[model samples]
Structures are given as structure tokens and as C-alpha cells.
Target: MPNTESLNVAVVGTGYVGLGTAVMLAYLGHHVTGIDIDERKIEMLRRGELPIYEPGLADLLHASESRLTWTSDYAAAIPEADVIIVCVGTPPLPNGHPNLRYIAEAARSVAQNLNGKFQVIVNKSTVPVGTGDWVTRILEDNAPDYHANRYAVVSNPEFLREGTALHDSLYPDRIVLGSASQEGIERLRQLYRRLLEQDFTPPEGVPRPAGLARPQFVTTSLNSAEMIKYAANAFLALKISFANEIAGLCERVDADIEEVVHGIGHDQRIGHRFLVAGAGWGGSCFAKDTAALISTGAEYDYDMPILQAAVDVNRHQRQLVVSKLQRHLHRLQGKRVAVLGLAFKPNTDDLRDAPAHDCITRLMELGAQVVVHDPVAMEQARREWSHLSYQEASSAYDAVRGADAVILMTEWQEYHDLDWEQAVASMRRRLVIDTRNVLRQLPSDTVLEQIGRRRVQETHALPMLPVGASSVHV
Candidate 1:
């Protein structure tokens, strides 16, 4: 069993990262105060209501209710805390650089509320490299003289996926800590002792992995730590783009992408994880982080052709959806097209950079009558995409009713389990575009299309081995 004492932790920003971190820390027996500037969000949290949607988060919050506090007042939460975690938003600007205004404001608030007690300020927000140093300067300039040495800054980037954020937090692949202050690092390490040792019982829904003894404890310089977050996200985006490129080639060559991916993925160096060819990746991280990295490169007079190509390919992929529609229907004008799934990915209502928006925009521009549906993100989409003129469907089946063509933009389980036969019966036409390649079966007369795959008419069988020949013989 791990030996540790509960400490008071103040988490700034009650968004996805902040809420998940605060809840996880509280679950580990720490007294955590979740601070956000938005009064409505704070009030909702205080009333035991979640401001955002994430699987297993509400239950975890309920489980850790005794140790958790919610407030908008920084002074009320920061002064008595032993550790302060900054998890504010660093949204992207038009030029691709991350706007650090929120980070600066959070730092100033932390500085203004500093107490005599020594505290470690952790940067849990995904900022550009050298942000930790910038945050340190901000705190120092704004903090009172008497508390000059009372706090230390550390860069601790987050790697939580939105849909499964709680599970990712409690069972991370690794925990990265980057700081110059040894004392600060030690205190942060102790704060995560239960996680480091994997001593606590796993939460009810988030079962521990089969052999996840402990997560790696990666220590590095503050700049390296920040770079790690950007690099990791950029690489994952590249992998997906690469797969999409291969899928394009496979279509031209009349080869199945699924078979090709499976054959190459078996090799040790090329494991099958994000090798999926789909509509394209869209979330809070990939596009923003890759753009930030490219922007950082441009600042240093550097050109990254590969990363630029990834971005270009992703944009083209979204446009390709419209192109495919035009190819099949000859023209989109007056055609009723149904789009299934609005969120970037399934299980979360985050529509930031969602491909569905781009596809819908193009379809509408070409005069197609568009209708859309998502299990959980319709309200979010209605709010953010209010300007777009489109019909909203109450269910996937309803979306397809009387539609000329259906595009499955997101791979939700609900879409996968949809009864294609029944759905096709309601459609004006029997055309389906499976961007995610998730549909199991369709009517025999229905026309099905997918990315990186084409219908082949002929099948060639391998030569049979001799009766007495060894199967392994070359």
C-alpha cells in the first residue's frame, strides 16, 4: 500500500481538463477545490450537476463529493491550497498560435491570492513550449514580495481523451513532471503517490487494465514537457492522415484498405492503433496542436512539409465527402441529404473542428437540403451551428427518412447497430456513404460506399498446397 497524506489542491478552470483532474485528485483522497470564472458553471457544479458530458465522470464526482468543492472566487480556493493546478483554455488564433490570455489571467489570479505557505503551481493546460517559464515570470511579477519564494512552477501536461477522460486520468500511460524546483516536484509526486503506486482500488466502471502495474513517471525540462504534449498529438494526427492517404491509393488500385492495414499492422514497428481511414480527425487537440506546432516552426523560419501535408490532406478529406455526393447524384441541388452524427467523435458532445460542419456547409452551399442527427450532440450543434440552415432529426432512423443519400460521419455505436434494411425502406433513395466503415449489413439492392475501399467484381484464390506438403514450406 502507498503511504501519503491528503493535501488541499486548487484547480483553476472547470472545463474538461480541470474537472477531470479535480475529480480524480479528490477520488484519490485529496481535498480539491474546483475554481472557474464562469458563475453559471460553478453554480451548476455546486448543485452536483456536470457542466459537460463525459462517460463515468458524473459517478466519479458523486463518489468523491465529500472531498470536492466548487467556487468561482480564486482567493477562496487558492490561499489555503497546498498545490495549484492551472487548466485553463489556450484556444487557437487565426494565425494558428495558441492564445495564452487565459493562462496569463489564471497566473495573475494565483499570484494575487498567494499565502505564506509554500505551494507548487502546476501548468496542466496544453500550452506552447516555454509557457512554463512565461507563467513563472507572470507569477513572480505579480506576487507580493513577502511570498517571493513561497511557490514554484511546474509543467504537467494532460493527455486525456474527451470521451474517456476519467478512465484516462485514473489509468494514464504515464505521468510527466517537468520542473527546476526539486522540492516542488517532490510535493507533486507525493500528491500523486496513490496513482504512482496504483495502490487504490479501481473505480467501479473504469476497470484497471490487465497488467497496468504502474504508469511511467517521466521527468524532463519544462520546455521539453510542453513540447511532448504537442509532439504527441501531432504524431497521432500524422498517423491518421497517413492512413487516409493510403486509403486513397488503395481505392485507385482496387485494393481493400482493411486487408492492407491488417497485413501491415501486424509488423512490430507499425502497430494498429490510429491507422483508421475515415472522414478525418476532428477534436480539441489534433488540429489545434498541429497548427500550433507549424506556427511555432514558422516563427523560427522553419518549414514542416509533412505536418503541412497532414493538414492539407485533412481539409481535402472533408471536401471529399461533398465531391463523392456530387459524383453519385451528379448534382446536390434540391437533394435531401441526411448526416448522421454531429460530434467530432462518438460518446462526447464536443463539435470543435468537427468534419460534419464542413460537409454540411458544403452541401448547403451547393443547395442540398441537409438534415442531421446525433445521440447526444444535437443540442450542442444547434447552439453552435445556429446560423446553418438544416433540419434536425430526432433519431438516426428519422434522419434517413425520405433522404436521397445518407452520410455516416461519426462511428457511434447507435449508428453501427442501426437496422439498414428498415432505414433504407424509409429513404427516398438507397444510397449510403459509410465514412467510418462501421455499417455491418445493408439491403442487397442498396448502394454502399466507403473511404479507401471500392467494390471489386472478381476474386482470385490462392493455389492449394499438395496433400503431403508442409504448410510452412516456402
Candidate 2:
């Protein structure tokens, strides 16, 4: 178990990272105060209503209400806290660089509120490399008598995936704390000792996963810690793009991309995670992070061709889906197109960088009359994409009814179990472009199109395999 020295922690911003950190800390028996500029959201949180949807968040919030407090007033949250975590959003600007204004403001607010007490100001935000140095400079310039070790700036970037933020926080793969100050690092480590060691007994229903390790603890320089986040996200993005690139070749050779990925993924080095070929990646992180990394490289007079290629392939995947639709229907003008799924990926309402949005834009440009349906993303589409004059369908059945063709954009679990019999009965035409390659084996009557698989098979002679490699007795 961790030290019972309860630290009062202030979490700046109430977004996914902030709220998850606040709730997790509070659940760990620490007094936590979550600060956000949005008063309405603060009020909503106080009323036990979450502004966003995350699995298992509400339960944690309700369980830790006694220890957690939400406030817009920074002074109320910052003064008493021994640890201040900056979790503000750093959205990408037009030039593909992350805008650091929010981080700057959060750091400034934290500095101004330092009331003669030592505090470990942790950068929980995913900022550019060297942001720790920037924070230190801001503190020294603003706070009185702020010398070395008076306050420590630790870069503790979050690695939580949306929709599973709560679970990811409690059961992180590793805990990385980067700072120049050894004293501050030890202090923060003690703060997270219990979680780091995985010593806490599971809270009733929250049984620990089998063989889940005590998360590896890495204490590194602040600069390397910032780069780790960018490098990890960029590498994962590359894996998806590389898979999609191979899928295109598979289409040319009449070989199945699924078989190709299966053969390659068996190698221990290349596991089967994110080896999916589809409309490409669309989430809050990948695009912006990749772009920012490329931009950062440019600042150092380096051009990242590999990252650039990955991004290009992702963009082309969306267009490839459109091209397939064109081949089937030929003329898209006045054709009724039913779009299935809207939010970037399943399990969240975040529509930023969603491939479905690009598909909708292109379909509209081709003069296709579009009708859309998503189990959860319709309201998001309506609010953010109100300019698009597309009809709304309550269910998949309603969306496909009288439609010439259907495009499966997001692979929601609900979509996988869709009633194909009813869907076939409702569609005016039989063409279904499943970008996710998820519609396993469609009914014989329906014409299926997948991103990585060829719709038309080319007759080919099979080469003789090694004796044991072949199951056929020829």
C-alpha cells in the first residue's frame, strides 16, 4: 500500500485527463479539487452529471464525491493543494503545431496562486518538449522567492485512451514521472506509490486483470518524457498506415489482407494490435500529434518522410473508399447514400478528425443525397455539421430504406450485429462499402466491398506448398 500521507491535489482543467486524474486520485484516498474555467460544466459535475461519456466514470465520481470537489475558481482549488496537475487541452493550430496558450494560462494561474508553500507542479498536459523549462521560467518570473527546489515542475503526461480513461488510469501499463529534481520525484512517487505497485485490493467488482504487473516505473529527464508521448503515438499511427499500405497491394495481387496481416502479425515483434485496414485512423490524438511531431522536426531542420508518408496513406484511404463507391454506382449525382457511423471511432462522442466526416464531405461534393445514422454520434453530427444538408435516419433500417448504396464508416459494436436480412430488405440497391472489412460474410444476394479486399476475384493457380504447409491431399 502507498504512504497514507494524504496530499491535497489540484487538477487544472476538467477534460478527460483532468477529470480522470482527479477521480483516480480521490479514489486513492487523496483530497482532490478539479478546476475548470467553464462554470456550467462545474455546476453540472456538482449535480452528478458528466459533460462527456466515459465508461465507469460516473461510478468513480459518485464514489469519490466526498473527496472530490469541482470549482471554476482557481484560487479555491490551487491554494491548499500540495500537487498541482495541469491537464488543459493543447489543440493543434492551423499550422499543425499545438497551441500552447491553455498550458501557458494554466501554468500562470498555478504560479500566481503559490501561497508560500512548496508544491510539485506537474504537467499532465501533452505539451511540446522543453515545456517543463518554460513552466519553470514562468514560475521564477512570476512567483516571489521562487528559487530552485522551491517548486518543482514535473512532466507527467497522460496516456489514457478515451472511453476507457478511468480504467486506464487505475490500471496503467506504466507510471512515468520526469523531473530534474530528485526530491520532487520522490515526493510524487510517494504520492503514487500504491498505484505504481498495484497494491490496492480491487474495489468489489473491479477485479484486477490476470497477471497484470505492478506497473513499471520510469523516472527520466523531463525532456525525454515529453518526447516519449509524441514518439509512442507517432509509431502507433505508422503501424496502422503501414497495414493500410499493404492492403492496397493485397487488392492488386488478389491476396487477402486479413491473411497477410495474420501471417505477419504472428511474428512476436509485430503483434496484432492496431493492424487494422479501414477508412484509416481518426481520433483526437493521432492526426494532431503526428502533425505536431512533423512540425517540431521541421523546427530542428529535419524532415520526417516516414511520418509524412503515413499521413498521406491515411488521407488516401478515405478517398479510396469514395472511389469504390464511384465504381459501383458510377454516377453519384442524385444517388441516395446511407452513411453508417459518424464519431471517429466507437465508444465516444469525439468527432474530431473522423474519417466519416471526410466521406460525408466528398459524397456531398459528388452530389450524392446522403442519409446518416449512428447510435451515439447523431447529435454531434447535427451540432457540428449542421451546414451539411443530409437527412437523418433513426436506425440502420431507416437509413438504408430507399437508399441506393450504404457506406459503413465507423465500426461500432452495434453495427457489427446489424440485421442484414432487414438491411437487405430495406435497401433500394445491394451495394455495401464496408471500410472496416467487418461485415464478415454478407448474405449471398448482397454485393460487399471492403477497403483491403478485392470485390472481384481473379482466377489463379495455387503453387505447391511444403508438405506440411498444405492441408489438401493432391
Candidate 3:
């Protein structure tokens, strides 16, 4: 068995998952080498600069700098690693299945550098269920001289949110390890013993959660571990979609959704975590994982109607922003529509499958001049959305000034503390579509539209669409 006191850990990939894992492991007293093919990212990490925006990550990274190393060469790191963690991105393909090209490449590279030392290969990426077996096969095929006893493959999926990744890593709800080999599981258990036992000093700004003395260390078959990740994300997405669906019905029935959710949330079984109604659930995890789960079921000839409907409802939620705009402006043609928020959520600059992207695209298609702003994602938005025709505002107020209508897509604290009275005074048409229902202390006369909440102006008639705009839908 390898020494658990201070193991040599090689974490592949420097994306959100990989970087967070490396930093956390380093803080836990492991000598971690973070390997990635991206030279620029590795160079940045070497200079103590973060490539991504995650709360408390940079501080934790700095604190763990002594035990951390960054490099682009896998051969330099993998051979000496007692634990090799594959945290590469498995982005979803057009057909809703995750493209495992990165996983395969990482596996092949790890296999080729075995160095006759027994190592445990851990899959921390969210991938398809059978990937553990596939990775094991690849390792066996690549390392001809080494026997099967030389290495073991394990599935250790991560459950992390972007903004709170450090906190999640330091004090996760549980630590799950799945492998056929008991030895592989035991190695990981020892590696995570400090976290599992809550024995380490809590990092500054990321204190241990209340009543969380120790987190469960769950172990299961490899397939079950992989499915656990997908199922957990899909269920969370479903909860958000369910809340949105009920929010729609609440509006139709003239009942307030906030009161309804609050009333039901009081029940012990249904706590009020993901029950808030909003523009929709948008992030890297929910949509991709839910789609992948549905695709997995289809491969086995199993139908997943609930998961499909969740996706359909989320897509329709984005379109509701445009529909609300049309209701106020009567037409989108030549209108100055300000989209307040570019990132999928508050706190991070991730725009993968963001609702704002869909809304802006539909608005542009309908001839509206879209001006967008996010607290931190503007640079990233410019990089990713340069081809799209839209103006980037320097601030939220800049985006809203003289705009015909404002759509609050993200609930940033800055947006919440916005000068609503002044914002309404500057707007040519004093209408604000609060998609997140988070805008507070609004001017009573200013037109405020919200999802699942009664509108400021109750109009039952549908507004007329602009010419050629009827074809545009999110």
C-alpha cells in the first residue's frame, strides 16, 4: 500500500475540476503535480496566477503553493504519482453523448508511463457509466510489459459548483469511490482520510459547514459511481424545471409562486433548495449531464420522458424573456434591449449553455439591438461571442441606460443593489423583466415583469410580433 500521509498525486487537466482537485489535495499535505497540455495555462499556474474565476480558489492555491507543481509534460509527473487523477473535460457532443476523446488520450498517456510502480488511476471526470472498464482496457492494451496487477482503475466523480468549488472540495457532502478492486478503493480512502475524517484545519474563508463533523465515504461498483454523478445532476435540474413549470401555472391561476413554494417548502421532505423559479437552470453541469443521461438510457432502448421534458421546459424559459419584451415594447425591431448578465449564474464566468446566450441570439434575430453586461464574464463573453452581433457594456448601468427594456438574466449582487429608480428614469420605456425575480425596491409605476409572479401591468392579450420576427425562437 502507498503512503497516505503525503502521497504523490498527479492531477491531469487544469480546468475547474482538475485545478480545484490539485489545490485541495495540495492543501491536504499531498505533493500534487497538475499536468495539462495547455502550455499557457500551466505557465499561468506556475506564476501563481489563476486561469479561472472561482471564489477563495486563488487564496487556497497560494496557501498550498509549496506542495503544488504545474507542468505540461505527463511523463515527468505520471511515473512518480501514487495516485493519477484524470479530470479532463468530457464536453457533450451534438448527439448528447459526452465526447470521451480527452479521457482516452489521458488514459493512453498514463498507461504508457507506468514505470513498473503500482498506481491507482482515478476517473474524476463526469463520463459515461462504462468508462472505467474502457479505461482499464486501454491501460492493459498500452502497457504490454506490465501485468494487470501493476495498476488499478477507479471511478471517483466530483460534485462541485463553480463559485463554491473550494468550499465543496474542502467539505463535500460525501466522498464516493467506485472500483472492483478493494485495494484501489482503500488507496483513495487513505488519500482522502483527512477530508473524510474532517481532521484538517479549515482553510480561511472556507470553514466547515455547521453540523458536518464528517462526510460519508461511499464506495460502490464502478458503474454505480458514474451513474450517481449523472443522476444527482439530472435530479437537481429536474427540481429547477419543476419549479419553473409550477411558476407558470401560478401566474395563470393568479397565485403567487413565492408563497406557494414557501408553503410547500416547509414540508420536511421537500426542502427549499432548488425550488426557486427563474429564467431557467443554466450552467455547465445540469444541461450536459441531463442530456447525457437521457442519451445513455436511449442506448439501452429505455425512454426517459421526465428528463426530456425538463430540458424542453428550460429551453422554453429562455424564450419567455423575449415574449415579455414583445409584450412591453410591442415590437423588437430597432429596439435597444439591455441584457443584464452574460454568465450562466452569479459568481463565475462560465457561459456554456447560458440562458443569456439563447435570449440574446433570439433578440438579435428579431432585429433588437442587444447590449449585454456581466460582472466578470464580459471578457470571456467577448472571446466566445465575438461572431455574434451585440454591444458589450462596461457596466450594468451602461447597458441599461436609454434601453427600451431590461432583462435581469443573472442575480448578481451588483444587479440586486442597482439604483432601480434612476434606472427606470433613464429607460426610454420603463420596463424591467426580472427573469430571476431578484430585483428589489423597484419603482411602483415602473413596469416590472417576472416569471411565475404577477406582472405589474396585467395584460392578458398577446402582443403583435414584428415582421419576420415570428420565425425567431430561442
Model 2 Cα shift for residue 85 (angstroms): 0.9
Better of 1 and 2 by TM-score: 1
Q: TM-scores, in order shown?
A: 0.94, 0.93, 0.95
Model 3 reaches what TM-score against the true structure? 0.95
Q: Where does model 3 exceed 4 Å of error?
A: 1-4, 456-474
* Window of ten residues with lowest summed lDDT in model 3: 465-474
Error of 1 at 295 (Å): 0.8
lDDT tens readout by residue for model 2, 1-474? 233777999999998788878988988888999999999889999998987767778887888898889998888988788999999999999989999999989888888888767789999888889999999999998876787768989988788888767667888898888999887898898778778877776654356788888888888999999998898889999999999999999988888888888989999999998898999998878998999999999999999999999999999999998998897688899989999999888777778889989999999999999999998878877888987889999898889877778899988888899877667556666678999988875555567789778664211321222222212111
As for candidate 1, its clashing pairs are: none
Query: In model 2, which residue pairs have backbone atoms overlapping below 3 Å?
Result: none
Judge candidate 3 at residue 273 and give its lDDT.
85
Superposed model 1: Cα runs more than 4 Å off: 1-4, 146-148, 456-474
Count backbone overlaps in model 1: 0
Residue 188 of model 2, lDDT score:
90
Q: How many residue pairs clash in each candidate?
A: 0, 0, 0
